[model samples]
Target: MSATLKWMWVLAVALATGCGKGATPLPTRLVPTRMPTIAPSPTSTEPGSADSGWVVAARGIEVRNLAVAGVVPDTAAPIYAVRLDPALVRLRVRYAPDTPQLLRTWVAAHHPLVAINGGFFTADNQATALIVADGEAHGASYAGFGGMLAASADGRVWIQALREEPYDPAVRLDQAIQSFPMLVYPGGVVAEISDNGQRARRTAVAMDRAGRLLIIVCPTSAFSLQALATWLASSDLEIDRALNFDGGSSSGLFVDVGDVRWQIDSFTTLPSVLLIEPRTS
Candidate 1:
């Protein structure tokens, strides 16, 4: 079937499912217009750096730092989590404290596509899961680049964005293909390496050794994403589903814990990030 037709069918199903009662409206938050403030850029010079990148949060959001590492590698940043075991993954549904309604409204306006479902993943012209999207970023040398989006049968999601700049078309394509196998599942643990030929930028996102849903951004890249995949394939971890999202200047990750939050941005840098922190009853 044609891609357009497939999407149409999916939308039909979503709306159809809401025909009965108990259909909550899609969250009303558009992607903010203001670029988020990203920490100073890291380099591939050190395979082991103390920098986990930046951690920024919107006001009124409470955050508790949980130390958990080893799920990926210490080469990333300081990891955080709500629980240390897979059983605690349910805390994600609790979400963080609320942000200003205006911010939520804004994100929804710019980001028109949002939903919930069993599986989520996306590539060029095709996306499975709740959302399928395209994202990009700029290199230090300054160039246009893009990446993919993938989601799992569970609610876990991953946004695979290119970390290296000065877009190298050949390397970008190679890395995207390599992303398929670079995942640590059950909680969305991922490893992203740039095509710097030296593995200068390496990042992994997962529930962490602590079971917190996280997006770890690092400064390191191998010749290909396959390098990371190869390592993960041999590990004891079992990844369920994964996806890739926009990277580079467009590469962003946001999380909120009660009144605390952390956000990584490429383009839209804000004093703090206003995100969809679900309510806890």
Candidate 2:
């Protein structure tokens, strides 16, 4: 068989046997692939500036612009921060079990102002936690992961650690997306980095003090979960609460603002995505 087919056959066998004889391990930290350097924009603001170790990937209106800034905090690997204004944007979760799509394809089909991989999923690409999209709940709440990002019908967005307060779907939330291991809570960083010390490209969804949503993606396989969380908690981004999403080869972000489109494509297919659309009056 060709190398590609051989690899596929091996993968099929592994999946069929469930990788053999061990408890299905929880998802671990990702190790990132090599990434090309992105040049910083000249007009980026301070703290998020080129001189300050951040490269502005995209910048425009807080709402309409796919504003992204890249930074490497202290000794950690590089990470990108995307800011979305909740007031001017609409947030939704997109998923189709029989029709999993690539991140770029989802962007093209939905034409979102901005989009990111939604959350963690099983090997079959099913969401691992409660998923409420368009005000309808798609799955039962699972406590395996304690962090969630939810939005109300009035355009308010918030992130919560469910360990302290269980997720109540009965609440008046218009949309909700859940992921694992709360990274940064209102009190402080809550994630415990594993000593096994695996690293990979990372992705997170957060809300800042001013209620703007932030989608963070690190394309380079460089940061451990603990390192990423620590940087976010201490950084100047003012993130109020942050939740970790699926990463490694599954992490990606896509944004389109007028004539310019900025994208960091994922190597794997994604079952769901958090989409940002313009608020329709």
Q: CA lDDT, every prediction?
A: 0.28, 0.64
**Which run of 10 residues does model 1 get worst, by summed lDDT?**
112-121
Off by over 4 Å in 1: 1-182, 185-205, 209-211, 219-224, 227-246, 255-263, 266-276
Tens digits of per-residue lDDT, candidate 2, 1-281, equal 99557534533332222111121322333234333323223322222223233333334223211122322334334455667777777888887756777788899898987788877665666665688888888765645445788889998888888877788755977889877667887765557744254555667887778777888877655556676787778777787888878766677877565433557776667778898888884
Clashes of each: 55, 6
**Best candidate, lDDT-wise?**
2
Per-residue alpha-carbon lDDT of candidate 1 for residues 1-281, written as tens digits (9 for 90 to 100): 99668755643332222111122222112123133322222211122334333233322221223222343343232222111122222212111112211223334433311111111112221222112112222112111222233233233433343333222443322111112222433343444433332221223333333333343333212212334434443433333323222122222333433333334322311111112333232
Query: Which residue pairs in candidate 2 have backbone atoms (N, alpha carbon, C) closer than 3 angstroms, thus clashing?
Result: 30-199, 30-200, 31-199, 31-200, 32-200, 32-221
